[model samples]
Each structure stands twice: as structure tokens, then as C-alpha cells.
Target: FAKFANVNDATSHWPTGEEVFTHLPGTHAHAPLIYVALMTFILIISSVTMVLAVEAGHRMDKKAVIKWMAWTVVGGLIFLGSQVWEWSTFIAGYDGDISTWADNGTLSHSPYGGQWVMGVDAHGHEVKQMVTYGPTLYANFFFFITGFHGFHVFTGVLFNFLVLRNVIRGVYHKRGHYEMVEKVGLYWHFVDLVWVFVFTFFYLV
Candidate 1:
């Protein structure tokens, strides 16, 4: 990648690597896969809980509905929290030593960039350099996409919380059915399924 960037920098007449880093979209090659996998797992489990809640609602099982709904809410919270951690780590960027060549034919070490590069030092020892200043658009688009989904999760949590509160107050019990749980369950399921697409296109693909 470093060689490619250097060759492009040397040849390109248009905007190239010499200027601000140019970022292309759909580059999930370096994304944290394990964290994404965990989040997917949690959301899938939450969807299952929603299905169980809807079934309990059909049977007018208030206790079962409340229990499953609570579990769903917990799952949503955990997913959101994981996202917070992931975002923080991403924004922090990579931490490593970098190498740069000066105009005076001298090489030096730096901590500027997080990307790795191979080079030789004054003693003819091979060393690794890091590339800094990643493309801004990549991070911007990432935040926009993930942040939007995070907001949806936040609202879903609040919605579930309200319904859970009502359940505890016996409103559904007096009404002789847990229809509200079923309704919210539908929305929750939709959100969970949409996230699968987001995870695939944004993180895995």
C-alpha cells in the first residue's frame, strides 16, 4: 500500500496522496471484525427475545411479556454501549511509530501515522514506518452511518422503556391484553434486522 501510494504521489497530476489523504468508500478491510460480530450477535439475540415477547403477548401472559421485553431492552443497551466503545476507539485512531524522509537525505522516526511502511535506517537495519493523516471522508462517513444507527437504537431503548413501565403499572393487564408489547416488538424487530444490513455493508463487506 505504501509503495502504491508513493508511486501515485510521484505520477499523478490531479489531486493525489501529496495533498490531504483521499479516502474511498466501502473500505472495511481494516475494520474491527470481532467487535462487529459481537454486536451482531447481541442484536440477533434481542430480536429473538422480541419474538418471544410477541408470542407471550398473544397468549396474554403479562409476566412473560414483561420479562422478555426487559431482556430485549437490556440487549439494546449492551449493543449501544458496545457501539460507544467502538466509536471512541475509531476516533482515537492508530498508535505507532512512523518514518519520514527529510529533504536533506536523512531519515527519522515519528509517531504521526498509524499505517505501516518498510524502510532502512542509517545502520542499514530494516525498520517499519507508519502512515498518518488517513482520509477524513472515511471517518466522517463512518460516524454518519454508525451514528445514525446508534440514534435509532437509543430511541428504541426509550420506546421499550416506556412500554415496560406501562407493563409494570398493570395498564395492559387491566386492558385484558398485551397488544402494546406486540406493537413495540414489531418496531424492535425491524430495527434489529436493519442493523444486519448496516453491519454487512458498512463493516463486513
Candidate 2:
């Protein structure tokens, strides 16, 4: 849907001369990209910690499992916090008008409204062009996709927390195996892998 929105004709959905579907506000300062990179780094590190925890579980090393699981939880938390910040920045826009409207819930006006550009025509005549920033569909897709993935991450974190609790209580130890840790680790790794695709399609493209 996002790809379709981006490539579809803008005459019916957006104003004329809209070259893109989403005009991320912080492109000049590279702020959005930096935040994305940071979040990706955090998730990658969390994946490593999960792997370590699983390895420790294989060896029945309770202390090592606790240590790595704790680190994984920390990493998940930081990634979530960073995602919140990024969402806030995206919604508010660099100018803050979108944030104001978002709070008011009034859609009569929007920051995506196009601006007039004065330039020379092909015939060297001065002409004024109405250049649209983008459409609101971008925001819709952004929130829906990222929020869906965020929920998955949240669930992964919750599951990890539960498994960690069980580990602390020696439940896995009593079972003579740590298969639960490995299971949760698989889920964590899947979540992290999904984020890589999301980041690539949403930001890199």
C-alpha cells in the first residue's frame, strides 16, 4: 500500500508537482536517519545479547543467562524509547505545526499543504508553480506499519521478561534444560530481522 501510494498518480490524491509521497522533515539535518541508525544498532545488539543468553542456557550457566537476558531487556527498552522519540519527531515535523494540529484533532488544515514556487518556464517566462510537500497517506502508512512492528517488539520484550523471571526462579534449571530461553531467543531474532526490512523500505528507499 505504501509503495502504491508513492507511485500512484497524485492528481486524485495530492496536489500537482508532488515529487514524492513523504517529505521527511529532518532530511537536511540527517536527524531522522541518525535516529533510525541508532535504533537499528540497539536492536542488533539486543539480538547478540539474546544469542549469548541462549548459549549460556545451553551450558546451564544461570549467572551468565541472567546477565545476558538483563542486557537484552535493557536493549529492547532503549530501542522502544528511541522509537517513541522518532515517532514524536516525525509527527511534530521540524516546524511543529503538525504537532499542534495532531493535539487539536482538527483536520481542516495540514502541514502537508503545498507551497508556491516562482521560477522560469521552458520558454523563459516567469511562472508560479504549486509544489506539494506530500500527502497524509505517508503518515498513515508510517504510523500503521511502525506501530504494528512496535507492538511485536513490545510482545517480544514481555515474553523475554517472563522467561527471565522463570530463569531466575530456577524453573528451567529444574526442567534440566533451557529450551524456553532458546524459544524466546528465536522470537527476538525474528523481530529484529523484520525491523531490518522495515528500516530499509521506510528510510533507506
Candidate 3:
């Protein structure tokens, strides 16, 4: 009888996590899932394209390798430009309605300045109404990780360009090896690995 009563008390009108979060201010939910998804898919597909390029290089199909590398460069540029646009949207907020929130025990908030991030401050409590703030820890991690990956892509394009240059000049043929493509493929794979984690942590969930 006692256990039954306690269980009933605990279950009666209990708010779900969403219900609790519904009252929070900074949960403004300003994400363009479409754009983000496109960018993610593009990067993933480009990784596959790069692998195909590397395989072509391995098989001594210089023409096929060059074609794929050219495509990879274009795809990489597209992804980078998309990210720049995404960042601009985030920074400006949507339709000039930048969200902002402050914790005054009551969760009423405003959207005058962009809600770039929601995170805890020095005392391990959220700085709810961050009107003008740079990268927080989460942003820091995302920037460092993703920015590093972008850097790698940029470098990869440069490396691929050089490889193409050498290939066109019959350098690889003279050397009788495709080690350059093989080595760069390893770096490309690392970029893909980092992106998988970023997509999971940042976008998916």
C-alpha cells in the first residue's frame, strides 16, 4: 500500500524533459537542419570520391585519378563555402530576430542579440543571457575539431593540385610510384573520421 501510494505521487503530472526544457530561454532552436545536412552529406560523399581517386591512382589510371581529384577539389570548395554561409546565419540569427536569454529565476527572455551559445560560466552555472559572446567550450571544441578538418581539406586540395601537376608532367610515371596519392589519402581519411564525430555530436544529437 505504501509503495503504491509513493509511486502514484511520483508519477502524477510529472513533466518530461522536453516539458522542463520548454520553459528554458536559450533553447531558442535556431538550426537549419537542411543546410547542415547537405554540408554533412557532401563531406561524406567527397570522402568516398577521394577514396575512389586514390584507388585510381593505385591502379595507375592517371586520367581517372586526375578527374576524381578535380571533383574532390570542387566538392571541397563547395563544402567550405557552405560552412561559411552557415556561420553567417548563426551569427546574424534568423530574420533579424536574434535570441537572447537571462536567468532571473523566471525564464522570460528576448531576442535582440544573437543566442550564439548557451553554456555555464566560471562558477559552473549557465550565463543565460549571452548577448555578445564568442565561442564557448562546446563551440571551442566544434571550431577546433571542424576547423582543423577544414584546414586539412584545404591542404588536401593543394596537395592534390600539386599531384595533378606532377602527374601531368609525367613525374609519377618517371618515379614509377603513386606514393603521393597514397600518403594524402591517409590524411583525407583522418579528416573524414573527425567529421563523423562532429556530425554525431553537433548535428545529429
Candidate 4:
């Protein structure tokens, strides 16, 4: 829908239609991107820990595998917690009314700030209305896509915990291998890679 959007059309713009459907520079909501960078770093480090765990498993070192897997699990937990905080903050909106726009020949006000309202248009089509405070669609996509990835992280942690349990039980040792650790490590690393792309496209860009 965004590809063929009419950039000059007022309907294409946000609430009050003073601006288009894109992040404007110098806006208050365009705060520092530090948290996203930190999240990326955390996930990337977790991938490295998974790699170390896999290497330890390859060498039949149960103690080393347990240590590295524990670190990887810790990293995943931290990342998931941070994502929850970010979602909460976004849903809460900004502190005060920030929507300002020039309509026709006069300035007007949209008091809701970044809040989004849904209603039927005159033509009976469903519409997602946004104020000048920020893009509502952006928040929607962010929540859905990032929330999905966060769920993946949560499940990856569970998988890691299960393998860690088996490691402690000497199951892999009895089998003369730690293939389970390697498999879970691969899944965890793939989760990290997906986050890297999401962070880059959603937060950084």
C-alpha cells in the first residue's frame, strides 16, 4: 500500500494532513536510537556465546557447554525484557500534545499527540488515523514484527534451557556426543540474525 502512495495527497499525510506519512526530521519523538543499538549488541553477543557453546559441545566438554549456554540464555532474557520496555513506552505515547499542522490557510490542533484512532471513513472503508505526533502505522508494524521476533527469542531460551538440562543429566555424554547443543545453538544464532535485520530496518533506518 505504501509503494504507490500519493506523497502530495493530504489523505496520504498524517492527522490534520499537514505532513506526509514519514518520520519528519527534528521531531521530538525522534529521540536517540541508543536503546536499539544496545539491543542489537546484546543479541549479537548472544550469537557469539552460542557459537562458543557449539564449539565446546564439539569437543565433548560438558562443563564448558553448560557455561556458554547459560550465558546465551541470559542474553536472550535481557533482550526480551528490553523489548517489553520499548513496547510499553511506545504504547504510552509522549508526555504532552505535540501535534501541529497547517491546514489550508490556517493552523489547527490535533490534541491526541501520537495516539491513533480507528474509524470508518465517509465511504465506509476502515481507516487508521494518525496525528502529527508520529506515524501510527510505524508503531503498529513495530509491535507486530518485533513482538513476533521477541516470541522467538522466548522460545529459543526454552530450547536452550531444555538442552542445558539434558547436559546436566549426562544424556549427551552417554551418547558420546552433544549434537543437541549444536542444534539449539544454530536456532539461537538464527534468532539473533533476524533481530539484526529488524533492528536495522525498523529502528536505525
Instruction: Return the TM-score for each candidate structure.
Output: 0.68, 0.71, 0.65, 0.70
Consecutive 10-residue window with the lowest summed lDDT within model 2: 122-131
Which structure among the candidates has the greatest lDDT? 2
Candidate 3 Cα deviation (angstroms), residue 186:
1.4
Model 2 spans > 4 angstroms off: 1-32, 95-135
Candidate 3 structure quality by residue, lDDT tens digits, 16-122:
21211222123445333555667778877878888888888778888888788777777778888876765554444444333333442212122455323443431
| RMSD (Å) per prediction | 9.8, 8.1, 10.6, 7.4
lDDT of 4 by residue, 7-42 (tens): 214344333211212222235454356566777899
Alpha carbon lDDT at 183, candidate 4: 90
Flag clash pairs in model 4: none
Give the C-alpha miss distance for residue 136 in model 4, angstroms.
Answer: 4.1
Query: Local distance difference test, per candidate?
Result: 0.65, 0.69, 0.58, 0.66
> TM-score of the candidate numbered 4?
0.70
lDDT of 4: 0.66
Clashing residue pairs found in predicted model 2: none
lDDT for each residue of candidate 1 in 1-205, tens digit (9 for 90 to 100): 2333353345322122112121112343333365577788999999999899889888888889889999999999999988886665454432321123422223322235533344443332322112222343334555777788889989999999999999888899899888888888888888887898777655543
Ranked by TM-score from best down, the candidates are 2, 4, 1, 3
Q: Report residue 92 deviation for candidate 1 (angstroms).
A: 0.9
Of 1 and 3, the candidate ranking higher by lDDT: 1
Pick out the ten consecutive residues of candidate 4 with the lowest summed lDDT.
16-25
- TM match of model 2 to true structure: 0.71
